[model samples]
Target chain A: SAVISQKPSRDICQRGTSLTIQCQVDSQVTMMFWYRQQPGQSLTLIATANQGSEATYESGFVIDKFPISRPNLTFSTLTVSNMSPEDSSIYLCSVVFGTGGYEQYFGPGTRLTVT
Target chain B: AQSVAQPEDQVNVAEGNPLTVKCTYSVSGNPYLFWYVQYPNRGLQFLLKYITGDNLVKGSYGFEAEFNKSQTSFHLKKPSALVSDSALYFCAHSNDYKLSFGAGTTVTVRA
Candidate 1:
């Protein structure tokens, strides 16, 4: 089990503005991931934050739109660039700890509302 | 591609009665299935996982899951439901360090 936290628990941003969500883990983790959850919907993986490298994005998501940075094992950030109303969703950060890597623990999530 | 499905969008049961949330998954190799619960305004909490070697696995809060490889199902069960147990549940499968999650099922236990 891991303790994960996200900054700016809830935010309201104007359209065309960019927002960066921070994820911090209590213990060092092997894998960190970013996800998006639409209103009353399931989660969609946005990217996997690789330490000291670019994030691996899933289909329908691009780096230019959702850039990620993982400077170390315990911290990562996901920036949603040029946001729109459609980008208003709950952004979550999850991490896999230790050797097993089978289970993932998630942060409380950042609720971004683009107006 | 690995995928998971939670057929029911919502499940309603009476408090103190037994409850089950259905899940099924598809993967190329052996499956690493997991169940997580999400309370309102909170993060997803890991309930249990089935990597191998056990048909039935118990987890926190007296919850358990039975992994039936033949049916490709891993259903979460609780012997007695509590009103506090009402929450959104997710079924997920892992492959290559990435997880494929189901749409999620909202469980409502009434007292």
Candidate 2:
């Protein structure tokens, strides 16, 4: 199992402000992903962070709204740009490791509250 | 399109009683099924997975899941429930590198 951690565990931000969340993994991994979970909602895949390439975002999410940076195998960042009240959600970073690396693991998550 | 369905929104079980969380899937090919648990204010934790071979897979926290290909279902189970086992549970299916998750089921284990 991979140990993952995120910064800014919980934060309150004003609307229209941007916040960046950092994800660090204890071991190097090839597959990293970002996810969003709205209040009482299921997890939604935001993007797939490639080590040295642009992050591949899912539909309904774009780079302009959520820019991602994967500088290396062990680290990545997701920036929520121009936040709104609706942007208030728990953002999670996950990675795939071990054997075939099919079993995905998640970090504690960043709880953002946009006022 | 690959998808997973968690039929129950919530499952309540008494402590020491057996518990089950139902999940079904629709995928083009053989599916990689997984179960994850989320405690209050925490991220999802890996419980168990069924990639191949075993029909019943055991995982962390004494949890296990039976993969029934005939029914296209992978249901999470526990022989005995604990109050600490109460949490939100998710069922997921993976195809290629993309993994899709179900809406999730909230499990409440009462003592």
Best by DockQ: 1
Model 1 chain A poorest 10 in a row by lDDT: A96-105
**Model 1, residue pairs in steric clash:** none
CAPRI quality level assigned to candidate 2 from its DockQ score: high
Q: Residue A100 deviation, candidate 1, in Å?
A: 1.5
TM-score of chain A of each: 0.97, 0.96
Candidate 2 Cα errors over 4 Å, as ranges: none
Models, CA RMSD each: 0.9, 1.1
Clashing pairs in 2: none
- Docking quality (DockQ) of candidate 1: 0.84
DockQ of each: 0.84, 0.80
Candidate 1 docks at the CAPRI level of high
